[model samples]
Target: MSKNLIYLLGSGRSGTTLLATILNSTMQIHTLGELHQVYSYIKEKLKCSCGERLEDCDFWKHVLSKMELTQEDLSTLSQAQNYEEQHRFIPFVFLGKNASSDYSKSQEILFKALASEKSTWFLDSSKYIGRFLLLKQLKFLNVKGVYVIRDVRGVIHSFSKKVQTTRGPLNTILYYLLTNIFGQICAWLFKDVVKIKYEDLIENPEETLHKVYALIDQRYDEIIASDFVMPHIIGGNRLKSNKSIAIKKDFAWKKNISRPKQILYYILALPIMILNNYKV
Candidate 1:
């Protein structure tokens, strides 16, 4: 019943991994990259950021063993009745309560093992709206949020570059709009929602992290920022593989995306953009 969870909520590719890396650099904080994407990691047979297959990675192997779970149990949660149920399955397993037939006793073991570890708080950069919604229902632990936002054009550009999908520009902008709207609603519904601009995080990390640390009641450490090593994060942007952190604003969308597309993104994301004080 401790304040165990600090979830970084946002759309994928919007710097969740970057934020997680910074938080994990601090004292008494440990971050697990993208818990919701565990099933995808297994199915795709993705390697951990440590360069070993996820199951073979020593860090995650320990986590899985302590959870009293196999890769199969973790994967099956994604196939649950719905995505929210999948999110709920995490806490259900953690509290040793079963909300699905797919669950096992690993949840309790994982919780106790993590508690015994030195980390006082855990970061879950799931970046999914449903995950945040479900996390709010857990009474045994404190659930706080960091809602990360980037310009819609930047997100679409990143997606277009990184993701293999062939989504159209309008569709991409609409999707970004909806995702931000969902994040805003979650922030509105939650108590300790800290809003972070992706640009500010990279351009002014120290000040941004200090604000975040204060909000979470943790002492800010200036040294942790410079020496951060990426943890054994699960599913997220591939940038996690970088050995060191660099804060660079990726504004290629300003030049790469056509002006009409930029205008379209602005039009679709206008209200939420204004709410976040984003310049259109």
Candidate 2:
């Protein structure tokens, strides 16, 4: 585990974060949220989830400036701070992009830190496979990845209501279709990759995560009771426009949104017909 990186790859609305949160609780497993900056770093004056600009937020500035912060530093800080503050250092929180990025240089900066950082497995819960592919090319061959999937209907629903993105309904659907399709293609392209259904994990978590953890070369003894049975719900946009890692019961995007949006989802998802045999 110490020699490898673990990535939870999926579309934006899928439940990659909760899985990362759970994995983060494991011994020597350091799970990072939305690390878009591994390829590029950006500074936005955007508001923090606490209604303050991220630039003005001392907590984030400290994290950004602090050189060589260890996994232990993140683990303790994340556990101690409010969820929003802890999440502030997330890659997306610091640097965000709607499209995939070329993070070769960023990977050099990040993985070098992780190699020496004290963690058995470094967890990445961003929903893009492009970054993973870029990292893979870096010759860091000992990497483990998970692809979490939610139904297309649910994903489009969540994307429509998001704050920072005001893409037209049609564009949202197209993005979902392309992302999922490319995601599946990447899953086929990568090694040591596993797939987890958001619904399956929610309905029968212990079994699903048992398999998930195993896929990443982690043992069951490392898991905690909190990871076993925590009822997760979703809410609150990132103070800086980010995606949720948890997909909760109330978040049935198909049931929650308007009919027009539903029709749009269907129309846009028509391309997914190629994956008719594909399981989500």
Candidate 3:
């Protein structure tokens, strides 16, 4: 079997989408946004940076069709559009909408059927390690996956923008510590896995993507040709995101993390950072 299927596994804000978009540009791949609706529905409502409703995209058009639903009946397909507020994990728990507690098995069937229908590549960017752990054991076993990791400081820095960093900072730091540690473990467990850093992917697109393409062994010309959503943010055209961002690099939320709070932030991150290194 050719390396026809590719999944982007990592936590949110770790540059999973950017890598996915580059793969979509690969020409041989027809990358879809996150398809964890089988395991998580949050992706169904989350808008791509491109600004289109994902369910309406051709990639999702193919995904939903195989699930035995149509555009007219999207409401009944999953609760993404309908459910306004939810814990992030609720949608991912696979609550028997398809009549089985084992969503991993059902997802594998959907994925295989999707592969059988076309020569396109599939990309899921939900960015959750728990989700990846569930799907890793499927029997189909022909998938080629990429694991995108960002510096933990970058992850905490990315989350400090919209929320209070009081406890949020610690939580974000812990999440980054936990998620990437899991990625490292998955690397040892799975054979078809490739790991890349988000900072490298964005700051040096061409060189890094060349490295990424080499790992997955996919051609890169067309993906490079297609327009990316955040060219400015990725290239040196913009400022770099701090290893741990208290404010968005765009300075879009400059007040979110103050210099004093940033001091506390670094202090908080130290133990978690040490824990990740020592425990891993």
List per-candidate RMSD values in Å: 4.5, 9.6, 8.0
Q: Summarize candidate 3's per-residue lDDT along 137-245 as a digit string, tens digits.
A: 4555446668777655566666655532323667876676666666666676677777776656666667766665665566556454544433111111011222211
**Backbone N/Cα/C clashes per model:** 1, 4, 7
- Model 2: number of clashes? 4
Ranking by lDDT: 1, 2, 3
| Model 1, span 95-175: residue lDDT tens | 544343332222234445454353377888877665565555555457778899888778878877744454566777777
Tell me the deviation in Å of residue 76 in model 1: 6.2
The TM-scores of all predictions, comma-separated, are: 0.82, 0.63, 0.62
Clashing pairs in 1: 67-106
Best by lDDT: 1
Which scores greater on TM-score, model 2 or model 3?
2
lDDT for each of the candidates?
0.70, 0.53, 0.51
- Mark the 10 consecutive residues where model 3 has the least summed lDDT: 231-240
Candidate 3 TM-score to native: 0.62
